[model samples]
Target: MLKLHFAPNSRAQRSLWLLEELGLPYELNRMEFNPKDLKSDEHKARHPLGRIPVLDDGDVSIFESGAIAEYILERHKNGGLKPAVDDPLYPEYLQWFHYCEGMVMPPVNTIVVHTLLLPPERQDETVRGQAQRLLTRALAPVNEAMEGREYILGDFSAVDTMLGHAIYMSNRLGCVTDEMTNLKAYVSRLETRPAFQKAMSA
Candidate 1:
């Protein structure tokens, strides 16, 4: 059985969602989000950075949601979630999968750091403004890509689980809007998934 170290409202949610989607039985080692819990020496042994998602499978351990998602799909043989290389959209799938973390999350992280996460004295308005602008620009392409499609690759995939978290962060920060109708609808669709709901509120 897999052992997942989880913290509510963290990247570990993505891994939990993936596990639920895969219907894989695992132990959820829920932990507090506070530094005392995450920064403990025991936690640091699993992850040098003491991150929320540290998956212990037998003798091997994995961290980072993207890598963990891929690991699950590869082990479970769920090609629908992650298409094989022979598939036409395989390249595109990899692109969007990586895009979620690479393009989307950086500014989202910046916005989060400047806005709610950081203390008033540490927050920077200039950085916030710049990140907001960059995040908006980053979303415009996703909005356009999502036009006439329910999902990124026109079918549900693991990439959505990866990127959806970033979009959720954007939405929570008021980055999503009515003008981005397609993106909003995309998020709405993701929200309706039972696995998503479970991971979020479970």
Candidate 2:
């Protein structure tokens, strides 16, 4: 059985959602975020960066939420979490899957840095405004792409799980607006999924 090192309300939640969606039986090794604990040491061994959501499947070990999502989808290709490789929507899946990590995360990280990581006195107003502006601009393309589509690939795929984090975080950060109607609706649609609800409540 797979062993997943995770914490609730973290990126690990996405992996848990994927496991639930696939109906895969896995052990959830919940780790507490203690700076001075054996579990923290073990977690560091599993993930050099000491991040949550590390997957250990026998000899295989992986980290990073997007990579973990893709790995699970690939491992269970028929699980319906991912489109077939030959499917026309596969390209969109691949694009948006990477975009969630590459494009969206940069601005989101900037927001995190400016809003929380930096001290109020040292926080640069210009940097915060620039990050907000960039996030607003970057979100437009996602909003347009999701217009009239129930999901990023026009079907529920790993892209939804990947992009879901961005949409949810953006909403939490007040980055989402009426202009992102499609994206907001997309997030709402995802929230209705049983797996997503389970993950959220877990």
Local accuracy of candidate 1 as per-residue lDDT tens digits, 105-164: 999989878887889999999999999988988988888888898888898888888887
User: Candidate 1: worst 10 consecutive residues by lDDT?
Assistant: 74-83
Q: What is the lDDT of candidate 2?
A: 0.80
Q: What tens-digit string does per-residue lDDT give for candidate 2 at 44-150? A: 79887788789988899999888788788777645476767788787887888888777777888788878876789988889888888888887889999887888
Q: What alpha-carbon RMSD in Å does predicted model 1 have with respect to the real structure? A: 1.2
Residue 19, model 1, lDDT: 89
The TM-score values for the models, in the order shown, are 0.96, 0.89
Q: Using TM-score as the measure, which candidate wins? A: 1
| Candidate 1 TM-score versus the reference | 0.96
Would you list the clashing residue pairs of candidate 1? none
